[model samples]
Target: MGAQHDKMEVGDLKQEANRASPVNIIVSPDGMMYDYLNLPGRVIINEEVGASGESLSTRKPVKIEKLYEYVSALRSNSFKFLLREYEELCEISPQCPQTVGLSEINQSKNRYGNIVPFDHSRVRLKPMMGKESDYINANFIPGYKNARAYIASQAPLPMTVNDHWRMIWQQRICIIVMITGLVERGRRKCELYWPKPGFPIKYGLVEVTNIKEEVRLDYLVRILRVKIGREKSPKSRHPILIHCSAGVGRTGTYVAIDRLIQEIQAKHRNVDIFNTVYDIRKSRSMMVQTVRQYMFIYDFHLDAWQIEGDPEGFKNRKMVERQKELDSKYKELTSKDDLMVEQKATYDLYELFLMAACCCCPFLFDKN
Candidate 1:
């Protein structure tokens, strides 16, 4: 009798499963019932009803494997969408250059080492050897007919030798207005002067410590005004060249700000500054590195609220203040005279090392 009853119970369960929507049921190996429902492609599994005329006492554990499978499917769909979108974007706006980087360099081992030839076709590759003079003397290449170039000295180094690389690589621009000890050294050693002949390098050598909200704003304003003015004319000037050291992080931020300002002026729309930066980085590799720098940009846009205020009142005042305070302390630490001197000496050594290394291995200088 008990065996008959068990058979009847199993038969009823099977009937129940068959009667329910094919999409909404899963019978586990342990005979635990799971009622699966599709919630916009995401699966929600509920426990089976109990024999006691009550819901199941135990909660239905999530099927992690099934969840991952569903997520993977969604991601695949998203990637396809993005690919289609990218293709359409390329077709519609061929003028917008795709981001390129140093990783594109060949990695095959040679007798000396991995040798990478400089590719001038790359949007981001800047020749290390060629001065502005060299570019002017050379005949215009097909695509580079409207090309221009500029160079800026890197910031002062940190207290230690290891820190020097960080300072030179991470510092944004060497502004003439606020000269760092490092900039001064670069000017002396490399004969690096502002506005080198045949090039219109902006001469505003700001110290590493002085790259504050005001400094960024000032630089952005200057670049945008120049770009806007030139764009107005029929015989407009060449594309403005902006660089720092490694052509990432700070350089990316500056470029992002420039592009944002341009877009704002053109569209008359207030853009999410953080989102703009994020988008730029997504399109390029290692564009912005530090979370601190990212927060600085966010704070800068937020502080603008004191004067103009957020029209929508969406700015997070508390978070902005916290970041500003942290950045302020960083600036204070960097501005000490002894530290500044140390930083300068370190940067000088790095520049010498870089120049020497590049000479020995020409491929090291190849940015493409």
Candidate 2:
């Protein structure tokens, strides 16, 4: 009886061991460990498992590679998504004017023939007319023996009211003014400080940062605030032209922040930021490119002090830290190499990972 009992106990122990063994170490499509069998004296394997357990660790390296590939794929998918959003936005925005013509005025009977009046309230034009004798009397005709001769000499180029209007409109008045750099020409003119000669108009330079440094962020905020002063007021007519190298990621981010501020001030709910940015990109092709930029919009929304003592402060700080860590890691991985090489490798790796991820699971890359 004791021998039979011992045989039964051994069988039970074997069954327990079988239950405890890891079930093929199921790894997620993203290369993360999903579960581990709970058994006594059973060896557990993970990504940190080294080469010594190579036979038993069929999954670790494969999972790590999959993880890298998955990240790359995610980045590529994000870029593609941004491109699609930009294309859609561009379809809904205004386009720049294509042509201007002014060559037919000399031969026309009417002085202002075919010339359209400036419809904008800010501009005006006037014409003048004088007789041939008046022109001769004023000594306006050159190289003439007498008044009549002078009058006849100037007859070919008939001076009319239309001619005077065209001259005044085209030559006497300056419509467009160009200023160099961030300082506006008008602002320079109004202030006591004299601007250097030939200073060009300045456009805002868009900058990207995962960690929001107070000084830089404050400067950007101040700039936007100054530009958007007393919304729709006549004091500021200048459009704030802002661009980064490609005029997308950073540019879109600033615009998003600006829009968010406005929405919050207006006390509007249901602010669809993605749609707002999408609308902007419709007019501006290179709007938002990077996932970091997209994520920045979320950060901007959450970090904004719309309400005093918002409880999200702690959560936002944690997210910000995570973002900084991710950015640092990405920078480290892609850094220490030539820019062209890095971009190409990053892009290629991203594509491959995306392909692999999509193959593994359809919805793996669709999480917001």
Name model 1 segments beyond 4 Å from true. Answer: 1-235, 265-268, 282-284, 310-368
Error of 1 at 265 (Å): 4.8
Query: What is the alpha-carbon lDDT for the whole of candidate 2?
Result: 0.28
For 1-368, candidate 1 gives per-residue lDDT tens digits of 00001111111223222233222223333332211111123322233433334442211221222222222221232122212222222222212232221232322111112111123322222222233111110011111122222221122222112222222222221222112222432332112222222344322211122112222211211111111223221222233333333233344444444444344434443434444544443333333333323333333333322223333433444533544564454343233343333233323322322333321221111110
| Model 2 TM-score relative to the real fold | 0.30
Candidate 2 lDDT, 189-228, residue by residue in tens: 1111111233322112111112221222112111111111
lDDT, residue 246, candidate 1: 29
TM-score of each: 0.31, 0.30
Off-target runs (Cα >4 Å) in candidate 2 are 1-234, 265-269, 305-309, 312-323, 329-368
Question: lDDT of each model, Cα atoms only?
Answer: 0.28, 0.28
Cα RMSD (Å) per model? 22.0, 28.0
User: Looking at candidate 2, what is the lDDT of residue 182?
Assistant: 26
